[model samples]
Target: RIGELFEETNGYVYINLQLASYINDILTFLFAFCCFFGTIKLIRLCRFNQRLNLFIQTLQYAGKELISFAMMFSIVFISFICLFYLLFVSKLDACSTLLKTSQMLFEMSLMKFDAHELSGAAPFLGPFCLSLFIILVVFVCISMFITIISDSFRRARKNINNDQEIFSYMLNKFQRWTGLKKANEEERYALIRLEYFDPIEGFPERVDQLLDAINRLYMTQISERSRMEKDEF
Candidate 1:
């Protein structure tokens, strides 16, 4: 059915022709799968090491900053594109379609578009105003985005350290609960280190008391069982 609509005899079948689109879809899916697999491997590696985990968290925070920036940028960008389209829709060929007008303005904001296109459309004033807009976006808006990301990195770094310490403390507790008490020495030291860095009032003392109580209870039960076995014998 697709072949009938997109027959070869049709003059100049664009690359978006049915068969080509199907192949493109398949390739795009495969590419996406490869990227997903690579990301999973990177996350696994990060989980295996504390430093790598911190780095990945920093990246994640940076990504969140970028997403927020992009959202704000998009609103401003679309507003400007609409203003330009309304101002020179008939004057510029690029503004013939809203999509094209937006694309042209976005490229101009990046200083990537041909200035002559705007100049040719509306002469001197057109290029001048567009140039000013681009300068403002590149210098002011983009600089603010960079600052936001930098701040996010700083906050993420601090949080990552605190989170890792807390995680180590919890992991130690888990091990102790699961009868791996001997492995908790390192965890105990970690908790002590955390106390020095960030004072959690009475938390360390409480955990130590709990552990002691568990040990004493286990010992008392064992002694009672041994006594019972001797009487039965």
Candidate 2:
């Protein structure tokens, strides 16, 4: 039905394809620019510790804006891809007709703007070059996403390890305060009991444990990746 409509309108798919290509290019450029510049600004904000409270607040605000922008950009690009696939893949007869027409237009000098000259000559180059470019861009984008996710995992893992160390340290210190041996399991357990139940200290040991466990679970993949790298090298 869409193909018939497009055919009646005289190969609108060609214009759609060209527009999709340009939009995809623009989106890729914007994604790269935002990721690069936003990362730099975030790093700078992290470095300037004088206004710690205000810095954290501003970071949160900036994060919300970035997330909104990214979501909108992703939605727009993905919609274009979905629409293109529907027209080009689902309606192959119409798509083939449109491609052939485009080629004929290129040959007969019907188009004032030549796609061959646009792509630096040789327009009907079997789609390999354009496909390769798209594949490479997708690969880079995926890699960047993976890198960001991996770093987040690393940070979570480090925080978990640090929390566990702190917990152990506190346990040892409380044991010492109670005049108990560090090697005594009974004494260590008693110290933990006192740290939480004791009205004087009243620390939230269970909450701390839960937070540490959550962080550790998040970091598990990153830690596994690190172990694999170490083993490989």
After superposing candidate 1 on the true structure, give the runs of residues whose Cα lies further than 4 Å from its correct spot. 1-44, 47-55, 62-68, 157-233
For each candidate in the order shown, give its overall lDDT on alpha carbons. 0.78, 0.53
**How many clashes would you count in candidate 2?**
0
Steric collisions counted per model: 0, 0
> What TM-score does candidate 2 get on C-alpha atoms?
0.25
Give the Cα-based TM-score of candidate 1 against the true structure.
0.46
What's the TM-score of every candidate structure?
0.46, 0.25
Worst 10 residues of 1 by lDDT: 8-17
